[model samples]
Target: MADLSSNAPANQFRIAVKKQKVWLASALILLVTALLAPDQATESLGFVAKSLTQTGPYLLLSIGIAAWAVATGADNLIARAFTGSPALMIFLAALAGGLSPFCSCGVIPLIAALLTMGVPLSAVMAFWLASPVMDPSMFFLTSGVLGFEFAIAKTLAAIGLGMAGGFIVLALAGTHVLHDALRDGVGNGGCGAAKIRSPKPVVWRFWEQSERVEKFGKEAVKTTLFLAQWLTLAFLLESLMLAYVPAETITSILGGTGIGPIAIATVVGVPAYLNGYAALPLISGLMEQGMASGAGLAFLVAGGVTSLPAAIAVWALVKPRVFALYIGISLGGAFLIGLAYQGWTLL
Candidate 1:
């Protein structure tokens, strides 16, 4: 027994040492990568730093929204609403998206969570389309940089497009695809359980529940951790783009005459993930280099929607048909909106 105990401790010590060595090796590799490609390293680090800074406040806001959803029992309310009529859920979701202040990245997970919790795909689609453009921060920024009229036009256009897209998706794809996409898993348990019954003196009863507090804390931690990981990855990707891709190249591709600008904008945007605020500097730069406002808008919309993280989340929760519909609608809507903006400018 004494010999076995000693051997166990030795084995445990070796495992701990091994873990430490592995971590050190990984850190060394990262350092080497950074030193070898300073520009890429700086860009990646800058992205992570910038994303963390922006996401700090947004994280708090998300927590508040999540809390509100939990408190009001509306987190999964859409599921209940959809039970009766999916179309109505779509409209409500679009309105909700318009009112929300979350950026594209911030909204994506929430939307996915909602879908996993049983929210209809149509509603999720509406929210995805509108949230970034209709966000208050984007509105304020747009107003400051682009003028109030432009801001209003963009906001209105986003809402209109969101609603139109939702309806179009519903009409073309039907609710079954959405149901199949979201039915299995959509949200945390906040919406899964039936409404919690309060005893007499409901206010007092609410305060008495220790379980709720614990649940809230756990959820807060989970969400924060999930967001932090994505934010880190996003920052790394953005930094790489900034360091390697020439701004002039972006402008040249999308700044020229004909539909070249629109095509270039869409192509460039599809793979790049950016928030409305983050994209603003790029948009301004593109504009300075003669990129059309329409193309810029298209770029913004496309960039916001096609995040790799968000796409992965969607793929995990939704069916291929629903996913295809989402991609098609977003691309189609962006193109049409861009064309309309271009024509308006011409007129």
Candidate 2:
């Protein structure tokens, strides 16, 4: 009989290729560009390299902080936001969400945990709205790619959206419109609920524990790879856009000082957004191509909240009506914030 051990290497290679599909696709794109347009390929490579170098420091810091939060178990502290009065919980939950290290996918289980704990839907809605929009790493990445001002505005927009969603749910809660929000069979949040179910005292000095130290190392490496691959793909696409996409086209479509472009952007963002990290460089390139700042903001905000992963999680966890409200709030809040940000820029 043939030895199965002989197949291990090939199997591992296949797994690696499958798992790194984004990187593989990016490489294929670069290869095709090199074969068809050598000069453009070279320029694109340089652009990606230079952009990565410039953003390296911010990337490292963001990764470090995220790893720290995970290793120290501090992320579980978010449960505190649900304990206070409904109004206070809404405010605190929004604030925690903006500052938390969770991502769109990572926040899912936590959301599950909150809901399973019988947390008020209004406060949970606040966290749900804000959590995916802003985080420590996102703020740093945004600042590095866009600007400090833009990052600050995005963070404020996140909190504002959360507040708006929370209060709206609170008002409607009296009518029992959202009373039985969770679906019938939705079980307690999977692994993410463990810490919340059984509180673990966060070890602020996690380095002291060998296991925590190992956890930090793994998290750091994981986050680094995740960010690197996305950013690399982003920069590559940005370079291609700069080389091929017409500036006048972008300007005519998205540059005008009006609500039309922002509205279009909010609508477009739902399907067009790549990933949060990937969109930054793409948006930066769009802005350079005369895409309006307001439009860009709207795109990011809308996409962040309603991206496929997050949207699917929300759909899977909630009743149909509750899911409708979530989508309505996300889209409406995104447009309003986009207009507000645009007006702020004018001032």
Candidate 3:
């Protein structure tokens, strides 16, 4: 018994190192492949650089949020975001999701960190659903290409879907159907769970303490490293798609206007939906090719929530059940929203 207990930690450490090596190996392989294609690699590298630049500020913001929440044990403070109404909290978070500049991939670090800090799964799920669907810039761009009414409808759908995801998780909280929505390993596999010290007042002054600084530093590095590795892997995969997958292939299939088309859109959106800004023109072009309004909306919503980049980001930090719930809500919501938009169009 004593020998087993002593070896348990060493076993865990070995597993962790193995995981890190896999990520490192994959990243290194991708780097080598990208280097081999000098002309295409230039574009891929450019995309990576641009992505990192944009994601940096958001990553830093996540670090600050994570640091504070961890150091001061402020999950309660976040818990107090509303008056005991999970629905209202979900609504507010959904609104913030629409407002933030992040694409879904960019927001994962924050979501991962937030969940790690013990923020309830419902609100984070709410933000997760809405953030990628419609940001402020995406809203305006969608309006410019798809028109004002379409833009407004898409925005409403984004928020409504967010609310739906949050409430769905809330409803299932005590039920076995979605048990452990915030699963174990959420705080980096429970590594720092016990080490965290809740300062009396959850404030900035606590940051001055050497112990607090040390804790914050460890948390920051752990989070950043985890996020950066997954993100780089996601970006490398995206670069491959961008280099090879033709845009016309997407628009061609989306021309059909029925349930089948919408279903196809949902599936395809995962790999094809780049980002809202890039999608506006593609969706607009699809419309010209007889893409149904509802199908188009479905594609955008589905793509936003479950795109490869974003899904990979979420999967890296969450358990299988939580990830499945996030996806279930995304697909289900996208289908409903698409159908609703179609009905409105016919009216």
For each predicted model, how many residue pairs clash, with residues at least 3 apart or on different chains? 7, 0, 0
C-alpha local distance difference test of each model: 0.60, 0.91, 0.69
- Model 3's alpha-carbon lDDT is 0.69
In order of lDDT, best first, we have 2, 3, 1
TM-score, candidate 1, is 0.58
As for lDDT, the candidate ahead, 1 or 2, is 2
lDDT of 1 by residue, 126-150 (tens): 7767665565545655555455666
What is the per-residue lDDT of model 2 for residues 204-296, given as tens digits with 9 covering 90 to 100?
999999999999999999999999999999999999999999999999999988999899999999999989999999999999999999999
Candidate with top lDDT is: 2
Instruction: Give the higher-TM-score candidate: 2 or 3.
Output: 2
Better of 2 and 3 by lDDT: 2
RMSD of each: 7.9, 2.2, 9.0
Q: Report the alpha-carbon TM-score of model 2 versus the true structure.
A: 0.95
lDDT of 3 by residue, 115-215 (tens): 77666678878878888788654565566557879989989998899889988888877776656555455554242232223213455665778887777
Each prediction's TM-score versus the true structure: 0.58, 0.95, 0.58
Flag regions of model 2 displaced more than 4 Å. 1-14, 174-176
Clashing pairs in 1: 43-239, 115-186, 116-185, 116-186, 116-187, 117-186, 117-187
Which scores better on lDDT, 1 or 3?
Answer: 3
In model 3, what are the clashing residue pairs, if there are any? none
